[model samples]
Target: MTDVSTSDETQVDVETASESESSSYDAAQRRSRQIEADLAGDAGRYRMLTGDRPTGRLHIGHYFGSLANRVRLQELGVDSWIVIADYQVITDRDGVGPIRERVLSLLVDYLAVGLDPARSTIFTHSAVPALNQLMLPFLSLVTDSELRRNPTVKSELAASQRPMSGLMLTYPVHQAADILFCKANVVPVGKDQLPHLEQTRVVARRFDETYGRGSLKAPVFPQPDALLSEAPNILGTDGTKMSKSRGNTIEIGMTADATAKIIKRAVTDSDRNITYDPQGRPEVANLLLLAALCTGRTPQSWADEIGDGGAGRLKAVVTEAVNSTFAPIRERRAELEADPGHLLRVLAEGNARANAVAEATLDEVREAMGMAYDLA
Candidate 1:
């Protein structure tokens, strides 16, 4: 009877082990399916590389443009890379000192805005040397005329009074290098950036066609797709593009009083009635939009709620809303400011992880382009 009991116990142990293994496998499969569902919502595929040129502090426009989407993407378990384009800033501006400060400030802003460092990797463009090196061979894949014909380049040049530098001209190529180096399959971009992604795909195609030895091996380059963002265009207080240089943005980290003052000074029409007519009443409409965004209420609903209020009353309501919305962010920013070293460590750790990926990609790129071991 004792021998029989031992045999039964061993059988039970083996069955329990098998069940545990099965449970783990099922959990992994469910996790993968959840990721697939998230990607399917945005068309298909995973992994995203999106960023901002750290020219100044983040504002409402940045939040509406890509930062909000980033928050959602992080929750969805997507592998996200938020690049602080420190090097790319030189294409538009001439100084590095301000850019360095902006990068650190941007890091603080990102953290305060809920970009949990545990979920997302935030790193500087210049710190990733391997990504920069990929630009050399990538430059060879496209012609000068193609670069000049890029609509983004044309528009930026027309907008800027500064002389176009070589860096500015090849800005698209550097962006291509950033995307391709990570083998990122998706890039969340605005409509204005489609041309740059197109150039990136072109480079990927060129690289593959030039050196894809088909033998069941991984391709030299994986063509990335632009995941165009569907967020609304956030207008500045002046009813134009929100820009720091234009003095139109309301800084996300500003005090409530400062934010209220900015809203009070916002441009508006002489219309007495509070209506949401964007075309005819751009300024008034902008105020309504701001209020709606702040209160988490629809513009149409807010317009009806504040009926009969003139533009002055509408501005006051909008100011209150703006102040309330950013209050938590400002508070968080103050807390982070008290411990600047902690923020630096987060950035440093992120940079090290980013560089690991960048270095591996650069090795593959150099080997494919026959640039490896020349110095050896």
Candidate 2:
């Protein structure tokens, strides 16, 4: 019954695989360190451009994922451009009508979250039509296969179980335009969004290699580097990715009782005792994460405190933390929403500022491609 073999070949193979993984991990660490050094050295010199789709009100996942980084960068005096991707809403939902209110809501959220218009240029994608003109040249740099291979697009299509529209397929190119138009040198993204940023880099590089190589030593468009957020992603109540489409998301400015109700209803394991087992108890861990992020404490510490009472106590803490932190934000959002005209004026001024940058960049692109016959 004792038939066990430990051959040299198997041992060598195992060692080889382990060494390979170790080498890759080392390389990644080195890269991360380099980026940290570079940002620390001259962070204000960097121009950041990041934003959200105005499909719905921003949620907890949106806040923790990248929004917090945006605030930090703005405070550090990095020239930032916050875009509202209005066109993107129709890429998936063509039937959605009257997005103006949603756009206003998103703007209010941005303001409520301390995204100062004085420091950041907040504008809608539709306002900067010149940015779209850059997309044609950018699209020529990318291929149909590459677009289809984009993980973000592939995942969305898979989830929808529908053939992707051309607009949906070329959304990455549109993203490239968004980055390049503003001459954004940095973009804050998550692990999943790295591919999209890479595609933008490729397009920028290809354009430079093809056109800018002759006149300009480097590309006219800077290949934007990612400023990956250190904050952990927040999950939905049901242990899935928080999403607006699924109605599983807790909008940041929801009433305190509503927030508590949603947290109370969040799924957790049958175990009466609480422990920080992410794999075994994802839902409970998520609640703990929410509390920890809101309170600046450790998830395990929260789990340890809620040892006997189970998920209910954890939910209560998370609810209180979130509401307490977001109380001022909600009040600001309400104040802004009450005076919609004042919000529009702010957006209008931002649009003018964005258009100035976008048009200047477009003029450069047209000149680079020898399409600007009117250039004097």
Candidate 3:
């Protein structure tokens, strides 16, 4: 690395990078505002695409971070498509678990969290052939350097226990296929996922410019925009980003007793005074935030209520708040879990719907590239 203290050229390059980042942030903010306004007026006109990798059961972080937002969008009457990214499980991990089981479990979580199957088209990656088929044309639209430079890919690679697979390297392209397959115009995502969405946008633009010209349709895919989630990043019991891998998450499937136990063990500062200082007292604040989220109150207000009652009182309040909030959902989840046949049927229906949409999109893609030889 060049020393910025001694090298003027490196300093200039650093400044340019900062300016570019700032410009991108500004552009995203503008686009986000416009998308928000459009959704408010005619939400049904927008099709949203979002999903999880089916790595494991979702926790509170997944709930507030994205799942709840998904429920909100579905309730708004937006055409929602949820892809259970079962195939992407192997992107970084070497050994595979029972994906079908995980997919079913994931579905239960989605349904329990109010993601109605009727409103959102929920399907798995491996089940949708036409969706995966778009990978071939999209692969050519991007270069190796572009794929390598993607921040999400880089972070996944750095964190992976095994060597990076070809699928992992071209992960963003596959994601582009996910978005474009349904021509999804609105993708709900967090800040970290903007780069992946940007790559999807690039693919859509390049494909239209390259193929959707000269006797073909003007554009075959919508340039999807990111619908940024306003949810604050919920930290795990350990004060880090909540994750399944971290073993710190309080999963929705977990019993109330289990949740209380976990909260009791959460890390906090030595100071007994209960306060909402995220930077200074992140652990305590995280607990307060969890309680606040569950109870529909502000973290500071919760802290004020606790009023130096210390971590023990805070944990008790959080436990009750969480258990009370999720009691109904857990009951519903049990009902769903009892009927494996019904779960399978839900997957079947979702898969059928996704296949039909994907087939139509793929047909458009073929026609645009002049690959539809069957056409007279």
Candidate 4:
């Protein structure tokens, strides 16, 4: 074989070839970004990401705070996504037997609340391997101090009553994966949840800065905006924050009898009159707020109608309104539960759709990072 050493002219051609490839890669990345920006402007096809943790069945707090907004957007033809963050459950719990049941129950709650599968996608965190894999790369994009300083994580850590685990520490990274996986741009959240979304934005911006226009960031995830809730702040029966763990919640899936029982036990003052004075009598006002929010009537109006009737009257009215408002949901939940096969099918199909989107995004990421090369 005749071997020819590289001459000056040949070396220049090789350098020119390298420059051309670099230019082509840069052009390709810019085109990808411009195309995504155009797609994002399609108002009719806007994407939203929101869902419940599988702590248990969602209550009215979930309804007014976030679920109602999700349903409205879904009906408006938006690409609504409901992520059942099942992996997040293990961050606080040492067991798993109950988690599967909670996931099923949460899915049932989603259906019962009118999250139609045809219009929206509902998938679990564990089902999409692509999402989990993303966290590994995304974790590097955020700092440890940033993760620890997150209020959401801190609150959960305190309530967990257990030492922080690695999973617990990097959960914000996991959350970024969830949002970025779908490339969701619209996020419905309450004021309390703003921090979580804010951290997601930080991670997205950091990832984009490191790899976006600057470095061909694949699947440039939108820095999601928080769609804040305009609904009234809902309080529990005991005049405290409404949560399932607090035992004061009126479950949306509960039968009228069960709902009535919980409302009857709700704390109220012995003022011998019904009033909406939250500062004067928070417990009594709490019941009025519940009924008002459920019925779309003012608490003062309720107090005016129930004058001198006391706690029994207020509780009875609230129980009636609460039961009536959610009666249809309760019925649907019963039907869905009886037909577990249908529920599983919906969830499985949603998981498939989610996996498709996530896998494609992951592939683009690999290709962008020059990691998709064939070793052979």
By TM-score, who's the top model here? 3
lDDT of 4 by residue, 37-117 (tens): 544356465788887678787889888777877787777677899999988887767755588788889888888988999
Given candidate 1, what's the lDDT at residue 103? 82
Taking all chains together, each candidate's TM-score versus the true structure is 0.85, 0.89, 0.96, 0.85
Which stretches in model 3 have alpha-carbon errors above 4 Å? 1-6, 159-162
Residues 1-376, candidate 2, lDDT per residue (tens digit)? Answer: 2233457667888999779756744554455456667776677788889888887788988888777778878887788899999988788776556689889988998888889998999999998889988888888988889998898788878888677788899999999998999889888775567778889989999988888876655578888877665768688988898998778888978998899888888888888798887888788888888889889999999888888986677777888999998898899988988998989998998999999999999888777787878836
lDDT of each: 0.80, 0.84, 0.90, 0.81
Candidate 2: stretches off by over 4 Å: 1-32, 156-162, 216-218
Top candidate by lDDT: 3
What CA RMSD would you report for each candidate?
17.7, 5.3, 2.0, 14.3
Judge candidate 1 against the unseen true structure and give its global Cα lDDT, from 0 to 1.
0.80
- In candidate 1, which residue ranges exceed 4 Å CA deviation? 1-45, 159-162, 214-217, 374-376
**Model 1 clash tally, residue pairs:** 0
lDDT of 3: 0.90
TM-score of 1: 0.85
Ordered by lDDT, highest first, the candidates read: 3, 2, 4, 1
Query: What is the alpha-carbon lDDT for the whole of candidate 2?
Result: 0.84
Displacement of residue 308 (Cα, Å) in model 4 is 1.5
lDDT of 3 by residue, 1-376 (tens): 4575559887888999889877886788788888888877789899999999988888888888888889988888899999999888988876559877888889999999999889999999999999999999999999999999899789977887777889999999999999999999988876778889989999999998999865375888889988877887788899888889999999998899999999999999888889899889888988988899998999999999999898889999999999998899899999999999999999999999999989999988888887887836
